[model samples]
Target: MSDTYAGAPAKPGTVSARISPVGGLDVLSRNEVARLRGASGSGLHALLRRCALAVLTSGNISDDPRAILEQYPDFDIQVLQQDRGMKIELSNAPAQAFVDGQIIRGINELLVAVVRDIVYVSTQLEQVGFDLDASAALTQSVFEILRNARILKPQVDPNLVVCWGGHSISRQEYDYTKLVGYQLGLRGLDICTGCGPGAMKGPMKGATISHAKQRRRHNRYIGITEPGIIAAESPNPIVNHLVIMPDIEKRLEAFVRLGHGIIVFPGGVGTAEEILYLLGILLHPDNAGTPFPLIFTGPRQSAAYFEQIDRFLRLSLGDEVARHYQIIVDDPETVARTMIKGLEKVRHNRLDTKDAFFFNWALQIPLEFQLPFRPTHEAMRALQIHHERPRHELAADLRRAFSGIVAGNVKEEGVQAIEQHGPFVIDGDADIMRALDKLLQAFVEQHRMKLPGGTAYEPCYRVLNA
Candidate 1:
């Protein structure tokens, strides 16, 4: 593999270069190379290109998924099969990803991860015919994806904490996330997140300092994302281990299975979707005894954010739902200490139940939560957000509702759908709809729906009180 950079004359903000695989992936079968090189609509090339571009432009602030593509319209990547290994050829790539002509090592690694995951999911999982419909089968598929990425480790303690929050947030909220992460790192905890900017980057950034101070080695900064959301929320530079699940369902499932605990910072619809997904799973009768540490935390200014979230969860899922998590305000140290204790409980529960330390095998995730939810206009309107249903069931639908709003707000497909067919109409119980409207309005008022510098956020859905 030649380290010498060779490419055409650089464009204003883009470069064309051929870079060898750096990490996570190197060799691919002849069949895999063909599929990757296939540019037809049905082939994996489009998906690879989008994800790779996102990785190359890591730490970008924009949430508009299409914005990046429009910025680098000619950017393309091709996988060249070689006898020794695989070579990645880039055309019109983001200039920021390269340093002194050569691609940045971390960006190269993440690019490889994009290719690795896209190929693995398309060829190994889909072509080989995994039964993704069944709940257990879907769970197994998620495990296979993670295992293939080499994220799951054996004989490790339960120390992975998944942090969820919006990419668009205030500097104050971002700083708070960093403090919480620093405290977690001081306690020897690793960080996992959706792998975007703002809150996702903050904790990982904070932990790096604390980990260095503590002389910690082999610390993992894992970033788990899926194809649809990757362009909107590129993986931050702090992420050393990046895994791209096929879709959002598997992405969320991977988080629950891999992380021992979860910390939610102030966020909008995306974060609410995550909270609802976890709460729905935890509320399942079978998972009642399982110990999963979940905390809602933010700075003092963001307390009202958590309060609104708490109220929404209680009103929609029931007051008992509050027991699943605790609220910590402006106190990063206490949050970390609480997480440490919660992790101890998780460790003991794993041992007592004879479960794997790296993966939560005992938790029961129903088929509803495991299935991928496409947020088309018709599908979004059909969601049943009534209170009379079982709490967990209602939580599942509520999660779907938020998931739709997230898609509409950022995901390329969802945004197009909303453009074509106005806002999604969410019809549910009168009280729940009112509460949902108020919460969503707060998110908009707080500039949580989209990054502050971008265009003003338009309502993607209408709440219909029934």
Candidate 2:
């Protein structure tokens, strides 16, 4: 997409404004406001600045997080509490977030979401003393974050479809995502995604139109992201609800817990990481009968992409892994139908197990998958990707491997790490190593590893032979 904002040039510069909150983030305690105003040394200011810049530049596509920061170095935001309610003041903000000196309504709401999540995490979650070490406690943290965002609805049935894919995707593949999303929306399903551009934005864009056609009021376009990623992949403009989790692990857990099903589009290592994360959980023997629908899809021209993904899964995790998902090429209607059918099974399964329809409480996600994986060079090299380990364990390590690649690709800290220490070395089982090398090579060749129009991607990792 073009870096330029759509419509009239957006006044060509920054503007200062104080605006009242809309919707969920209208009220906050005095302590919360003070916490949000903490300086850079205290950690809240820097976090707030980066996330706020991302929101102001929504829809402008550039994978490099620092690029946006450099462009608008003077931009800043502050939460101002007044007698009326919560008010936000922006200084030297991006003009794109405003039209004719007034902030766009959608962007304002998302900006509020950024503040709400940051303050909630800093104050509520940390102060509550929730035991983060235990798996159940960690799961509860995810629930609490979602609940604080008003994401969990008690009366709603199983209808949320969590779409996972790369923020950088081909136009054809992006259109395919929209078609699938349109089909799902027509069927009354809601959309949730990583809240970025490209494939993440495509589905929500399509679903909005379908929802309008069906006269579906209060249709949801939920976007979930984390601090490490929000700068690079800002919440797309279509998102009606936004939530920021503490880390990628919690973010992934939130998606699985809140959604009824998952649909994956052609993407790079980030998408692969998500697929493995879900598969790892589903492969656990305890989750055998869980009816979570997963589909890998793209345009007909992208058939080879899904084929490569399928072969990799089979070769690494065995053919039994194939039972957990379907590869649907170029058939949006069938993908939607399949998801609809699978959701029926999911609804029945929830009823049978006496689990809540909104959250997948019964899904036994091992603590290993729930824990955060910091992809340092040493940590990346230490992963045991051999076949001797259980399939789920191997999948978790493989997911980490991909997660490292994703980090190096877009996240600011990961990029700095790579620049300082050179590429991360990943050595594992011979066969798995070879498969990984081939897969990454394919991603580079297909321009899936980075945004197509940006700088050429340098290898962030080296897969060593066993």
Candidate 3:
């Protein structure tokens, strides 16, 4: 509990405890039980270990998620289904998560989240009936995952705000996000984010104070993440409702569909990728008339940051794309007011359109956006970033370019590829590639690419002029 600026690194701990799986997760199929039991290659144990460790080390500082694994290479998680409930046994878990003997309650809940989502996705939802390849069906699958996690609320009146931003952001930018979150919470809105540090965690932290002051009960600090990038950016301790989506695409889709409104804070490649994903869908001819409220906000110090982002969007997707979002800086109250007003419109629009308030059933997310992009060397080179295609289609490619950059920066497979092969080669229209290169460089120069004080940000992909 000492808020010392620096302290000796806490040595790791080992614990044995029995925790009942929350929300009937204990009733998992025997096959699901066996998969969690696997600690080796054939079973889903490796995925379970990485995710469990990430939760146990919630406030992790290093962006190279592999760092912890390498440090505690023998760390293992086991699921024991007894006659009573479920017990999660952890060996070589991080010591920071425990005070005396028992694990922190919040960390325990998050650990359960790791097992819950991993089991659900691996066992039930990925079956042939899920039809993951079908665009509309895939969107439904996102709803199913969220619903199964009990995230989609039936009686809510549009108060969930999904906050998007980079894990590595400036101190000033991070503070600005708190102000925005405070304002939103004061107005009775819940906050959701990618569940990492920096911009993603700041709002939730800010909102907690406001919600406490307002005596708001049942305030949800929802954190939605996928395992691939999660180790690099562990969940911020504030996240109470954590759901791990199967992959990045489904993760993004879950955010858009589950929340009533979205606010983009100043960020790096990951943030840019999210912006492009929404822009692409918003610009789609079928979705042009939807009433989703989107805003880009930051503190006054972040004006230059926004300017850089705005320039990139206009340059890459054309000036008309500006119509999809508004940039409000330095004012949390206005950001809150704007979101409230916008969500009112969202509610009315949903009622009039007969769309479910829990999920945006009407949003037309095409197959290209739904399917996961591997960001392999060949795939990065194959992206179609140009001016001639429809703006939405162009946004998808731009999204892929950013996605590849994000992968190269943090995801496990992406990092290993960069180590084995050199940086990924991204070929695109001359002007677009130049702009992309410049923006990525700024991220590194500002130390927005990786957690501060870690190794210098390494370029993960090379941009080629078309």
Candidate 4:
């Protein structure tokens, strides 16, 4: 509830403050406090520091994961247990996170979220020995994490729309996303996204105005992110509810299970990864009857972008995969109307199946999709991206390929590996590799690989015919 400025000489653009816990998290056990205080290489302190810095610098636009760390190297955070509750002590934190002399309220809640997730995952989940290796167990673990975050709303109907897009996009495309979001909000739908800048922030920005116009209250702008990509794409200021999953796999699962429908905008490898992940699961025979609304849309100027995505997808996953989603161009009203109709189908289907409205318990996600993929050089080369396999299986491996490229482009570990071992080599069927190479080239030429102000992007993975 209170914070003090550590009135001492500090790095420019950085300040020191000890702030009280916000609403998200307020108390921790003695052991939890000790573990958070631990600064060893294996302890939670380093992870806490990185995630905390990301939260403190919300709305930062940087594709380089290391940029924030390098900017404020001395920044640190600790969880201090006290008589009444717990307090968060921040050292050399970003000055922008504070206004006048107090920490920004929203940023404080997000910081508390960072602490809450790190502690829960380290102490509650891992220590309890959840068999994360098993598929069912893994899904259960994801549910537990969301439940612990209090993100699962049982009374609410199926209204959350997951918006997937890139942080680096043109002003035209960004404006288009906001337009779609505005239309969606006017229809009484909620917005969820990866929680970064650019397209992720656009829809939420648009929705706020429409919501206010309609006199709506308690609107949810949920942002779901993982540890590896948080620093690269910090949560935008519009994200009122932020949940950090343990890894990318869990993060993807949380999106599909929580949202009633999805809207994908123009993006690069990361967005492509999301598209393929959903397509792969939907293609599963067990989920063939499930009604999940998916739409791909953008401004008219970006038509070619979606065309390229469509071509690549049809080539890789076959023409039938196109049935799962529709592409709407330059029409936000139609996009919103289509999504509303789709949600009704989702609603009826859920009712008939006797499933929970908040979570999609009936969707069948296989073990392959649940497992976390560490995109190393050897693993990248081992992907089977040929058309000889089942459509869903092929989509799974293709998703992994895009995921690896995303890692090498932004994630710290993946970047380090690429620097030390060189760009990853992806070997697959000749035609598939050719299509992938062309798609990736388009992303680079369009500057979709990174934020606009950064240096030109270098390919982090090379595709070759096997």
Candidate 5:
């Protein structure tokens, strides 16, 4: 690894440096290092470069997948094996990730996490003792990934609250998320999110201050993400512990499995997708008695957002689905206090069920929620979004529909697919389609579909008449 720096023409914000691992990643097998150093065209190297660049350009706020690449077209990262250990060499990296020529410690740690998870998912987890087909095996794989990341604590109680919302949110909604987070932190709770800007970053930011004021130490601010979305929604600076799941399904699974409770704020299709996924799991007959806490909260102005979400869920799933969660508006302290009570029930439930506190081992995640969903044109069109099926099944398909919209809106492959093949066509039951169309239209009207200043929002999928 060379110490020589590489900078773009007239751009002093680029840097070059060689950095070693801090903690999470220390040694890699020869095969793994070779794979990481493979040619740019190779799948491994391309993924490594993209994820590494995402870490270097932390705090970047664009949702377009190609934004970072265009900004730092000459940037490059290489994994080098030394006699003692492993190191990463960066050229033309973002200057913001450095201080006086040394890479920031937190950024370096997250960079190591990027390399660690990507390598483990690609090389390991499949050789033996792992099966993606069986639901149990797939759940174990999720557990193993979090365990490998050292996120699953053996002694900790149920305090990690998973916060879900959009990266493109309004100022008031964002501030409300922070206030809720601050309240949670003052009560000695931790936070986890998607690791992006806006609502994702706000809670963690607020919690940091509250954690400090309360003299909390070693507080967990974990951020779980996947590779396809990381480039567009780069990890926020507040994410001290980061884990990149293999795909969206696994990422969603990780969230439910690890956190004690979930708090949702006003968001677009992506947030709606999360709500539907969890509700689908809860709707399963096997999970009827489970005591998982789920909350939808935001400022007074954002109450309409949750109302629209509640209407869509009821119209698509059922009124019975309302039993799974509660809605609290314009009250951060109550949100936090309510979560604390919910966490108590979760704690008692886990204890009575003989489950681990660090992970929700008893929740029955159906195979449908565990399977990977690729958002291709045919896959999108083939989704069974009718209400005739079981509620969970319908929720699963509905979740897929929103997931595809999310991919088209931000993910690189989905964007390219839209460019080449045109917008995806989604047709379903007449009533459900009408409800979905109305909800999606509201998202566009509220400016939740994309970042406010980006190009005029375009419908990525045409909701055909059912």
Candidate 6:
């Protein structure tokens, strides 16, 4: 969240610009703008611009942060107040966001989401007056933010399936994910994801067609992202609802809490982080009986990827961890049918336990999994990745290890950190470190670390096998 103004070019399109407010957001106070301007320099402002720009340019393919910034270098967004409502003032903004001099409706909606989330997180989430420390309070705050964003439908059924996977993936694997999504949609399930390309986009694209066929009027394609990763993988065109959490931890938590079940497609470090996070929660003894469906799936070509992931999980988290998820390959219909059966079981469990169907109220997420990880070099080096610890705690550390790699690979702060400090060093138990290193190397070989067109991704972290 650092602001880089020195030597950075100003918005290219113009010295000044004006735009009207539409849809959900329409107001901002002078006090808010002054605070925004004041806080913009302290690092948050640069983050705002990067995320705002990503939202404005929805289908941006380039994964490089500098390239995206350079493309819309002249774009600057300002908050303006009015008697009737509030309007955003864009100075030399991206011409793509405008159609015949008027903002495109979808882009405007996403822009409002950017402003709404940024302001809420900055003012409410970070405020000393708010009780952000208590775990229940933090969870409640997530609920409030989603409610304010109008994402949580109180009357909706337990059918929102959160799909977790990599942004960069193989073409056939992506098509398989789409087929699975189509089957799920035919069965009346909604889709949610990290909301980028590859596996994330596949399901939504597939479901859109089935949803149309089934006349499912309220098909939800929800996208949950954070500022750190949004620039690299901008919201895919299929995203109808986008909510940016304050960080990746909260975003992952939102997925588990809001979704009825989870589907894991082939992914790299980020996907591994997500898997470990979920398994850690479900592995907790208290949550042993909870019925939350988790599926690890891919096309036939992706079988090796899941096999490696499975072996790593069995070796590190214990074979007991296998109780948590099922792997289905080359069968989209079976994947959906398996998920549907799991959802039915989940519904019964919710009814029996008196928990809400829309959110997993009974899942116990420890503070270890809930807290934000800064993933500094020292932190990466200090992680205890081993077999002796409780499985859940090990999962937490493993999740953090992947989280650090994720930062190094994409996040702006991470890139800057890597630039300043060379490469991050990840040290761990010899066996676990070897497996982790091997999996990551495979990701690099398969081009899963970054988008296809960028310069070859240089290794950002070193593995130290102890």
Taken over the whole model, the C-alpha lDDT of each candidate is 0.91, 0.89, 0.85, 0.91, 0.90, 0.83
TM-score of 4: 0.98
Looking at model 5, which ten-residue stretch has the lowest summed lDDT?
A: 1-10
| Candidate with best lDDT | 4
lDDT of 3: 0.85
Q: Candidate 5 local accuracy as lDDT?
A: 0.90
Give a tens-digit lDDT track for model 4, residues 52-94. 9999999898879999999998887878888877888888899
Residue-wise C-alpha lDDT for candidate 1, range 166-222, written one tens digit per residue: 898999999999999999999999999999999999999999999999999999999
Candidate 6: misplaced stretches above 4 Å? 1-17, 39-44
Q: Candidate 2 regions off by >4 Å?
A: 1-12, 39-41
4 or 6, greater by TM-score: 4
TM-score of each: 0.98, 0.96, 0.95, 0.98, 0.97, 0.94
**Candidate 2 per-residue lDDT over residues 392-418, each given as its tens digit:** 999999999999998998999899999
Candidate 6: give the clashing pairs. 11-74, 12-74
Model 5: what TM-score?
0.97
User: What are the runs in model 4 whose C-alpha is more than 4 Å off?
Assistant: 5-9, 39-41
Can you rank all candidates by lDDT, best first?
A: 4, 1, 5, 2, 3, 6
Candidate 1's C-alpha runs over 4 A off are 1-8, 39-41
What does candidate 3's lDDT look like per residue over 149-258, in tens digits?
A: 87888878989999999888888888989989999999999999999999989999999999999999998999999989889989999998899998999999998888
- What are the root-mean-square deviations of the candidates from the true structure over C-alphas? 1.4, 3.8, 4.2, 1.3, 1.9, 4.0
lDDT of 6 by residue, 279-312 (tens): 9999999898888899999989999999999999
